[model samples]
Target chain A: MAFRLIHASDLHLGRRFANIPQPPDGNIRGRLMEARHASISRIAKVAHDRNAKHILLAGDTFDTATPSDSVVRQALTAMGENADIHWWLLPGNHDNLKDAEPLWETITRDAPANVHALADASAVELAPKIFLFPCPVAFRSSGRDLTANLMDIPATKGALRIGLAHGGVVDLPTAVLTFRPTETVAPGSIILRLATGTDVSKSAIAHIIAAAPNRIGSSMDGAVSA
Target chain B: MTLEGPGAPPTVEEVETGAFLWINTELPLLPNTDCARALEAVLPDEGRRDILIRVRATGWASLQQQADLRQAAARLGPDFAHFDFDTNMLGTTYDDADLDDIDKAGALRLAANRLKEGTESETLSAEERAVSAGALARLYAYVKEAAE
Candidate 1:
């Protein structure tokens, strides 16, 4: 049973607003964030309109370690618009602060059911064939990779196993685009995580992780059969 | 990783990562604890495990989120780039700037050849990377450093 997900990251809302004040499209906060949010809204609308089951936010929805109140409100409003969909924001390292940034807590407080912000690694059975795990950077860890932190992610028998996260791909430093394939499952299992190769520095992320395969980044940097 | 305070003379190791953090001997460090706190503030605490926190070369955090790991860090240097902290399976060819060439390149070629041999294999194209990437990168890096 193959379903669809929105694998978006680095929103950095209210962060620096890169390279510009306004876009040719007349949107504010840099073309990137606006473009992403626009796409997210579109995805939400699509999910709502199509009744999609899941909406995965890999990480960095907010720009700062401490996102501003309005920024939090804006995120909530945008997500709230998609009342029907199961909106989940796996706290990226940037957004996952020592304390729950007002931005996220606000959402949790406002919409308990609609918004699920898992700030750490958790195995939640979203569907019958899919056992999804999200690794959120809820706190500070030194000298360790968070993806490989858990025990046996990418379940043994499942049609789809996904990991939503907000970190770059590991090991291969030369290639910034992380679509080199990874190992979230055992040696020969057809499992997949919905990330664009996990590297944030490259462009193939959207095309590789989000498009077609519907893959997102997993902390595990191994190869999966899928 | 060396522990440092804010606005203190960074250790020789810290200087290596090329943080561009100025070394001011005159002001001196406020204190090691203070420095640690300040440096701690620089990195996001969201995902603590994957952030490779080291002190030797200017206080910095290198996060490995598994997929697209280090993408943002490489994109906007010194910017507040958000990266996931994954400790799971490691890519066969990733080298820190600090390692030497012979060691680094040696690792790469060995891994690549190992993959090519298809003897004791694991992960994606270990053969492809083991041939040289992570290792040679370190070697090339050393040569460049030596030339400098």
Candidate 2:
């Protein structure tokens, strides 16, 4: 049986959705702001329901590198509450490795046992035969493919190799317009873009993984569910 | 095509071929009231009309704005045939598809198909071809940006 995992990223917590007009008396506004946390809780519920032992977050867990104390505390509390699900948090462009030291420190200090920050760009086993290679973003806009070294990751026979990352997959412009490049690629791993405000449909993700029990590739693996 | 007052007589300017009414503007999106008024101004009050509104602009649209516009469109009923922001705005072009539904592999394949048609088709203008190509690229970027 394959190791069940839920991949998600670009949480962008504490983001002041400024364009969305804040209602008077701040009731709806509060709910709108708290929606991000609600989303996290929803993700946790997805993990619990799907029997996903691991929820791999590619990056940008927080909207800002140094989020407010309350935001940080709230996020940490949520992680603490969902202690059973393994959370693999990777540093992304918004939460760069070098810049967000204090925040990372706060996370490591208060985070539960299940939470793991994939700060280093190396291979680590999620299960006996399931290996995860995370290429965390060191800088905000490093003009280099973070997953360039993913192919070099030593292959373990019969092992499920999954790469967790953040940023864009296709970097070059294709006659359209100048597509902004970011460091969010893990070559061998199936790259799933989790943009801001996208409700990470747990059922869909689970279905995709369940369908491709052997390996999830860069293809229409979710067509059955789609 | 200017956005005149509500009671202003309908005056449509043809940008491309066919029965399309192109309203060239600099603003990203029309205000809710303005949008409704514009709709009323363009569409004939009685009978069926294949009203195509193409809002051409170097405009900006937020995710919320798009949602609001969509809501406005829904409320306006099926009076208009097709109402979309100009493809120039990423919000207008690649915003319809719930990219999460299709995998990167499938999207790429479909994009390839569209691109092939876009490049090979002789009847399509340079602008149409460019828009088609841009749509795919933007789609790829968006899907990858927020894939699960």
Candidate 3:
């Protein structure tokens, strides 16, 4: 039994794009704004096509801490449309826990059955024998590594542990780093660069392909950048 | 029995069987006689076992006010089930009902300053420090916007 999932990050829905100067003629700003919302549907379609039951969004699902109510509701509706796909939303620097208290509260209150907000640092069962350790961002930045305690968390015997987090990997300067989700990186592997302004919309999608009997082994399966 | 701090005091199963009085530490000083009288008046109510007395503070107190508050706490210690003198400085009494824009802004500025200082205060526990840090981050964008 393969445990396949889609890994995505930095969707930044409800971004106004004020920094980017709009061209006079084409409604580029409106289209760009629409693209962010459209990306959710696109990701859903990909999940359907790939037959992946779970979509692990690493972090920064929204552009700002406080997005418009419409953005939140519509996004939930979109995910709700796809009842079978489990959408795990993680808090990132852009939509951190501290600044986005009401935003999270709204999500917690209104999210569909399919949507799971990764709002705390705890181990969650992704599937039978598959567990995810989420490192939710409390503030915009911190001196200590958020994922440092991943190794210390205990999981069921012979369970495949995957770490889901959103942050910059030390010494990595690239905009996006790709990893084969099924293949095990060496123990204590760091993944993904922090997504910044403007580049967040164009963020890459990393597919996680977990085949049967592949024990993630001692350390969490490093996060995928999408 | 007297209790201190926020939230409901332990149930009768958790603590001794007696009337529980929960007091907020930031409350203004009241005369010990008045406090005793109030407690005594409540003792006749057979149905209710717990009393919640909240004395809200209008602003940060002066040194004299702090001393008075401590003295009052000490005087009232014998009446409480648990007398905690260590004040948890998390409560506020500011009512926003009648405040105009200027007053609201002023209050925000004061709160931001207090949170900034509280983040650095060694007296604060780790949990309090974390809360202060979160509050500071939440206020940063607004403060920056106001400055601009």
Candidate 4:
């Protein structure tokens, strides 16, 4: 047995304050501005403490696509701790908020290997044991969803074959799946739902696809029935 | 070890002329950093040192304050550099509408310019330097003051 992967989603990093218009310079709206980093650090620490081999951050590391210096620094410091566990982060729509925000741009350019940002569909040999096939959300809002694209990869051979794409099957137009779902899924492959929480609408679309209910009222409570 | 030089310290009173600046950092960091503790004792590290000394007009010193703070930091020497929190975006928040293209471009420009100007004075032109410093002080004077 390798290491169990702790899959979490929708960490609205820098959204504690209202928006970019207010503290364009910087401010911790309430305690939450700092809490985002605190959340990430605790997550990293838990991942390591649990001996989790892999960490999947589906999207929206920063609350808005355009993050501030404080938010970026906080995330960096938090995520930097768990060098042992391989952390794979995808840029969802919020992270796609790059135009006005320079913070994410710098982060994309400067992230370490453990914190790999998936902008396109690719394959990662995660650790000594696992392999991850993922479709990273490059832009904020893509014309199509990521699940449809990743499921079309030609090869589907790995020990713990996993998929870390942005959306589920319901979100995308059926005409563009490239091939069929058989190209990616198996009984053993785990689908990690990493959604960027910019709005409820976008997440709802994602929720329907994976059949995981991560977007809309997605709770472990009734999630199995959902 | 003869530490004192010619103009180093004529007397104890003269050495006291050198000032120390304490800047408070509004960061949720785990405390117990000794150097910052000493500086924060007298002066507060409220937030961005660059924005504080350069931009915000507080009761004490203004951008005009840079001249004096720089001098003080110089006298204080390497000990001050220790308190320097490398805060590019120490604390930030975003909203819904910044999702627009135009808004993003403007925000990026502001951050990029701040980065380029804050760390690189010599590389920037006189016009660029003036813009970054928000004053007409020569690059030489700005750097010398900051180096202090």
- Which is the leading candidate under lDDT? 3
Candidate 3 Cα misplacement greater than 4 A, ranges: A171-226, B1-148
**Model 3 steric clash pairs:** A204-A226, B2-B80, B2-B81
Q: Clashes in each model (backbone N, CA, C under 3 Å)?
A: 66, 8, 3, 19
Which ranges of candidate 2 are over 4 A from the true structure?
A23-29, A171-226, B1-148
Write model 1 residue lDDT over A1-226, tens digit each, in one string: 3355545454555555343324255433343344434545665765655456677767666656776676677666777775667777777656675655665666667754677777546677666655567877766443455555333543364234455555554454433222222333332222233343443222212222332111123232221211
Q: Provide TM-scores for the models.
A: 0.44, 0.51, 0.48, 0.44
* Native-to-model Cα distance after best TM-score fit, residue A90 in candidate 2, in Å: 0.7
In order, what lDDT does every prediction score? 0.43, 0.52, 0.54, 0.43
Determine which window of 10 residues in candidate 1 chain B has minimal summed lDDT. B12-21
Ranking by TM-score: 2, 3, 1, 4
How well does chain B match by TM-score in each candidate?
Answer: 0.21, 0.29, 0.27, 0.24
Error of 4 at A220 (Å): 11
Q: Candidate 2: which pairs clash?
A: A166-A184, A192-B147, A193-B144, A193-B146, A193-B147, A194-B146, A194-B147, A195-B146
lDDT of 2 by residue, A1-226 (tens): 5456666665667876454333364443344346556656777777787677887777888878889999988887787677788888889888988898888887877778888888887677777756778888898899887766655555454444555667654432220121111112322233222222222223111111211101122231221110
Alpha carbon lDDT at A88, candidate 2: 85
Per-residue error for B126 in candidate 3, Å, reads 51
Order by lDDT, highest first = 3, 2, 1, 4
Q: Which sections of candidate 4 miss by over 4 Å?
A: A19-28, A97-105, A156-159, A167-226, B1-148
* Residue lDDT tens for model 4, A15-49: 65342122444342444345445667666665666
C-alpha RMSD for every candidate = 22.4, 22.2, 25.7, 23.5
